[model samples]
Target: MTTTPARERTRHEIVRQAMGLFQDRGYSAVSLQDIASAAGCSKATVLYHFNGKAAVLAAVLEPAAADLAALVAAADQLSRAAAQEFAIGEFTDLAVRYRGVMDVVQELIPFIQEMPELALLVADGIRLKGFLAGSDDPLEQDLAGFALNGLTAECRHADGRTDEELHRLCEAALNRLFRPS
Candidate 1:
C-alpha cells in the first residue's frame, strides 16, 4: 500500500526523534513513550509507526548499517592492498558521518548477538576490521583491527571536533594502527 505523505512524514519524525533519544539515553533507557513525547506524538502514534522500541532502534540504525554494508561490498571488489586503503578511507568517513549511531551501537554490543536486526551490521564490522588490519597472522590482525576500531569509536566522542576534524583524526589513527612496521 502506498503511504500517505503525512504518514511518511510522521514516520520519519518518529525515527529522527528516536535516534536522538537512543543516542543520548541509550536503547534500554529510551521508552516508546519517550520517543513519542520527543516526536510530539502520543505513545499510540509510536506504536502505529513501529511495533515497539526495538523496531525504532532498528530504524534508527538501518541507514548506517546499509552504508557500512555498501562500504564492505565495495572494498570486497578491490585487491587486498587496494581494499585496505579503500576500506580505511570509506570506514573513517562512515564512522564520522554516523557517529551518533556508532555510539548507540557500541552501547548495544553486549546484546548485539541477540538482536537479529543487527546481525548484518556485526558481520560487516568483522569484514571491515579484517580489511583494516591486513595481516596474515590472526593474532596480529585481530589486535590491529580491534585497536583501529576502538580508537575510531573513541575519537567520535571528542568534543569540539568538526566532522572533518574527526575524520582526519580517525584516519590518522587507523593509518598508524595499520602502518607497516
Candidate 2:
C-alpha cells in the first residue's frame, strides 16, 4: 500500500488549514502569514509548498475534483435507480463536506465572470460524466456537471428535508435524465 509522503502530508495540512481561513475571511483577506500561523508552520514552509494564495486554493480544488470524479464513477457503476440514489447521497455528502470551501468558491463568481478562462477551468471541474448510456457528447456531459451544481445548491438551501426526501428528489431528477421511453 502507498503512504502519503511527509512533505505532501504537511502540504495537505497546510492547505486544509488555509481552506478554513479562506472560507472564513475570503481570498483577499487571507495572506501567507495568516496561513502559516493557522497551520502552525513557518511562512517559509507555506511558501515552500505553495507559491501563493491562489496556488493554495487550487491545491484544495484538486482533491475536490477527485472526490467528485469518484462519485461520478460510482454512479456510472450502479443500476439506473440505484445510480440516482447514489448520485443524490454522494452529492448531499459533498455539499455538506465542502460548504465552507464552496462559499469561498461562490465568492469567486464575480472574478470568474471577469476572467473567462478561469471560469472555464472552474466549470470544467464541475463537469459531469456520461451518467446516461450513449450520451457521450462532451458538451452534454459538461452541462450535466453544471446541472448537478444547480441541484446541489438547491439541496443546500432546502431546510428540514430528510435524507430520504433529498435522495428521492435527486434520484427522480437523474432518473428522468436516464430513463428511456
What are the per-model C-alpha RMSD values against the true structure?
Answer: 2.7, 5.7
Lowest summed lDDT window (length 10), candidate 1 = 147-156
Candidate 2 Cα outliers beyond 4 Å, as residue runs:
1-9, 74-86, 112-126, 129-181
* Model 1 Cα lDDT, one tens digit per residue, 1-181: 9767988899999999998988788889999999999999999999998888888888899999899999999988988889888887898888888888878887887788788767888889888888887756798578766765585467547687888888898888777777655
Native-referenced Cα lDDT, model 2? 0.66
Alpha-carbon TM-score of each model against the true structure: 0.89, 0.58
C-alpha positional error of residue 28 in candidate 2 after TM-score superposition, expressed in Å: 3.1
Question: In terms of lDDT, which candidate is strongest?
Answer: 1
lDDT digits (tens) for residues 65-140 of candidate 2: 5677787777767776566556655665665566555666666655744544345445444433344322566775
Q: List residue ranges in candidate 1 displaced over 4 A.
A: 1-4
Best by TM-score: 1
Evaluated at residue 8, the lDDT of candidate 1 is 89
Which pairs of residues collide in model 2? none
